[model samples]
Target: MNKVLKQAIRAILPTWRTTPVDVMHRESGIPPVAQLLEARRIRFSARIKSLDPAHPLRPVLLPRKYASEPLPPLQTAAKKEAAEEFNAWLESVSPLTVIVYSDGSLSEKGAAGYGFTVHQNGRSLRQGAGRLGPAEVFDAEARGALEGLKAALRLPQSASQKIVVCLDNIAAARCLRGQPSDSSQGVFLAFQAPAKRHRQTDIRWIPGHSNIAGNEQADVLAKVGCTHPEPMNAAPTLAFLRRGAKRQCKDVARAWWNETAPDKYRSLNLDFPNCCPPELDLPRPVLHHLLAARNHHGDFADYHERFGHDDAKLTCSCSWRKSPTHLFYCRKVDSRHRMRLAPSPAVAIDRAIGRDFEKFVKLAQSSSFFEKICPCL
Candidate 1:
């Protein structure tokens, strides 16, 4: 099945048979058959997990699990509104009221971390930071909120005293307000116990990077946690694993192309996994001509001779061999049409195969331009 798919992709790219599979996959941005099947399986499993408890297929698909505790009350507001509300609430609260700020960070290298700061009135009381190793930012956010709540609970407070946990990630706040179904289920469950015991506890959302002091402090602490020497030995989330898989596939393909791609193809210097190139949106025949020119595989004397097309013309009307580079210098093509594409021959060829598509599409679709260059067309 993948072989058929590969043939179809080659036809679309209009590349030569000698083109490496890695190059084809890199240019097309289509994963192999196995990767696609694995992605489908992951999606199916997630669907099963989202089904209702009473669903008949739920038990058949997955083993029965204990029900999660009800989530704490959540308060959310728009960015500007949230900042204003939070500031007003801070001014009105007593010195005894506990306010906790939490944040999460993910590094470019995929390390994840969480940070929290617990405060009373305007004074900082406690702060915590930790590494979650190979985890998603979502997990880090939930864990940070959980740690902040735990620190707030440890502080001495009356039964009626208000405890508010503030975070910038609204999705994490909403998840804590609902059932726990993601990879961070254990952390959410742990948070539920203390929150349920304290009736005055509430989770609140605030806009991140809005110049809030506590949020900024928490953000710094999270970055610090990312540089920690040791990481927590926690199981990676399903989402994290899925992302890693796709990234690995692309990395392997890129490495293969860099090490073994033909010199002619390598000279183009195209990036691997060139997903959604603007040229793909052009009309089909125009796209075909553009790709053929880029790959050096269309209506050229060398290509025809290699494929044993004896009847095809070997040279242009100007008596020069029809080749990819000849399109730039062929005097048989009208100089006006050539200059419309580019002022210089080098720039014209670069624009034809480069990332910019606007000029290339115009030149390719221009009446009689390709026909003048290659009479065989």
Candidate 2:
């Protein structure tokens, strides 16, 4: 297997200078090409340590046989009314439950990571981890749940085992379990094989960032796992794919703007649109109307002239044609009225338009009244 993989890597990687590994390491602070190659070779060559219960790495960190006989039961959040009743039942049934915890994390810098630990009978039976380059938080979370469940299945199977997979994300839980019982189904059916061996597999929802020990541990582990040299297993799910597609679209949009946007916009100081298109900051319909009017493409006088509205005259109330350029100095609208409502309504806006188009867009987003002066309304 190792030899076949080595041959495949050699065949798959590009020629030296243009190789992805070479380009990846060209960035400052990245490891040298030789060191990176060696690491990859070792990673691909070495047999992965299994997550089986008998594996040396399977035991919980700081393993010690506690004389306590059994650890405390993992608790789920409860409403005020059920708080007391829920704890009483949770402790009673914990011994029959194998609580599995999973979590994923993404840093502000876009680093993606996930971690999971399986504990039963007061001992962590297994721990699994993985990570990715900058990615969406939702994708990381979904992968955490999916891979955690898959890892739990690799543990020693027993008919007596009652697995309760705990994840803080409710949406991810619903996607996995399919339904409420051990029989719920969702996007992935990987849990079915483990279900047959274990008497039951339940996905339990817990509140995130609320300091639940298992959940917290999972969160911390995911963050730590982000530093791993290579991700363990990145299984793409529907959500992950969807996020990837959206990211691709954003990238394409940015590229188009960079390549084809007016030269005048080069000095614009604008924030990246994390959730929407670059130039659009309003609701879709409103954005459409505003853009049409600004570009002389809507039901304006200039547009009507070309499309032949009843009045084919190209003129505004101020005698200047109702066009985008005409709006700039048409005198149809007084700068004083707009000044009262602009971010720098009096004169700063015109300055921004000359020096920084992005700053103008940002200001424009907030001042619809001022936009009327230049079809920007």
Candidate 3:
């Protein structure tokens, strides 16, 4: 599959047969088939783990011990409604029920934090917040749910006291009701312990950024947690690990390119192993011209000679040897066009193929411009 995908990439890039596989892959901004399959497998595994107990494939995929243990029934409220309706519902909840509003925040530096405010009988009972180092926002959300449950359990309560945990993240709220499958499995499991003891516990999802007082307070506390001096030790979640793997892959590919890529390609100073090049979203023909020019595999006399093509012409119409660098100097091209290129050959090529790609595309699409630049094409 990888071999086939590489072949397709080469065709799309219109690069020479001898172009490095890594160069084609990077230029096309496509991952290896293996990497794609691994990502899919990870997603499928998470889905299977989150499946309902009654799902036929769930029993088959899971171990016998896990398959037989029925997931505890969790009361959930995830309906989408207007802010007015939600406020009305909140005001109508029984005064005896403990309402815990939880929220999660992610810092710019990748720190995750959780915060919760517990309330009852129209008054605040307590508030808590904490940081989880090097974790995802989803992990923080799950942690918030767990911590909120713990806080509600610690409150002085009568026999009729029930608990409702409200979270702004629907995914986190829903995940709590299902069997634990993600990186937050431990936190979710901890939440289940208290929830089982207090059978009247309910998990609810509220719209985020809707200006509710409790939700806003929880948001502020979560931001405070993000700035905490010390973060608690927490294992990296599956999402975090996947991101690391992707970065490592790119690093490896870049190292290989630096060591083995031809000097001609290296001179352009293009970002190697980039998964999303600027030209990627452009029209296919436009992208093809850019890649071909960058790789020096299109309409060049030296390229044709190297590949033993019959119609190879060593010199341009103005008698200069046809080469990748000759495009900026070709006298047949209009002085106006030449003025558009940078004085430095490397910068000129880089801009033509990358930085100024849209302009390059316009020129490439013009028959007069393309013919003057490369008559052999």
lDDT of every model, 2 decimals: 0.72, 0.51, 0.72
What TM-score goes with each of the models?
0.74, 0.47, 0.69
For model 1 the TM-score comes to: 0.74
lDDT tens per residue, model 2, 1-377 = 44454444434322222223322121111333343455455443322221223665552222222323552333444543234443354567766466778887876665778888877765677787778644445555655766776666666653466777777766666655442221112313455445534647776677677646677888988987676664446443334444555555445434434554432234333322434233334444444443343223554564566556674545555555555334334554445423232464434444444333344444445444234533421
RMSD of 3: 6.7
TM-score attained by model 2: 0.47
Segments in model 1 whose C-alpha atoms lie over 4 Å from true places: 10-26, 31-96, 108-110, 231-239, 274-278, 308-321, 326-359, 365-368, 371-376
Q: Which stretches of candidate 3 lie over 4 Å from their true place?
A: 1-12, 18-22, 29-85, 91-97, 158-162, 227-239, 261-269, 273-285, 302-310, 313-349, 366-377
Query: Candidate 3, residues 1-377: lDDT per residue as tens digits?
Result: 98799878876675667767767876776766765666566656645544445774654342222425765433334443545566898889888889899999998887788899998977888899998866778888898888988888888863358898888887788767666645667788788777877878878777888887888899999988888865446556765666556566666556655776666567666666455676777777556556767777776777788789876767777888776556556777666555465587667667776567666676555535445556654
Location of the lowest summed lDDT over 10 successive residues in candidate 3 = 59-68
Worst 10 residues of 1 by lDDT: 58-67
- Candidate ranking under TM-score, highest first, comes to 1, 3, 2
C-alpha lDDT of residue 164 in model 2:
78
Error of 1 at 177 (Å): 1.4
Which pairs clash (backbone N, Cα, C closer than 3 Å) in model 3? none
The top-ranked prediction according to TM-score is 1
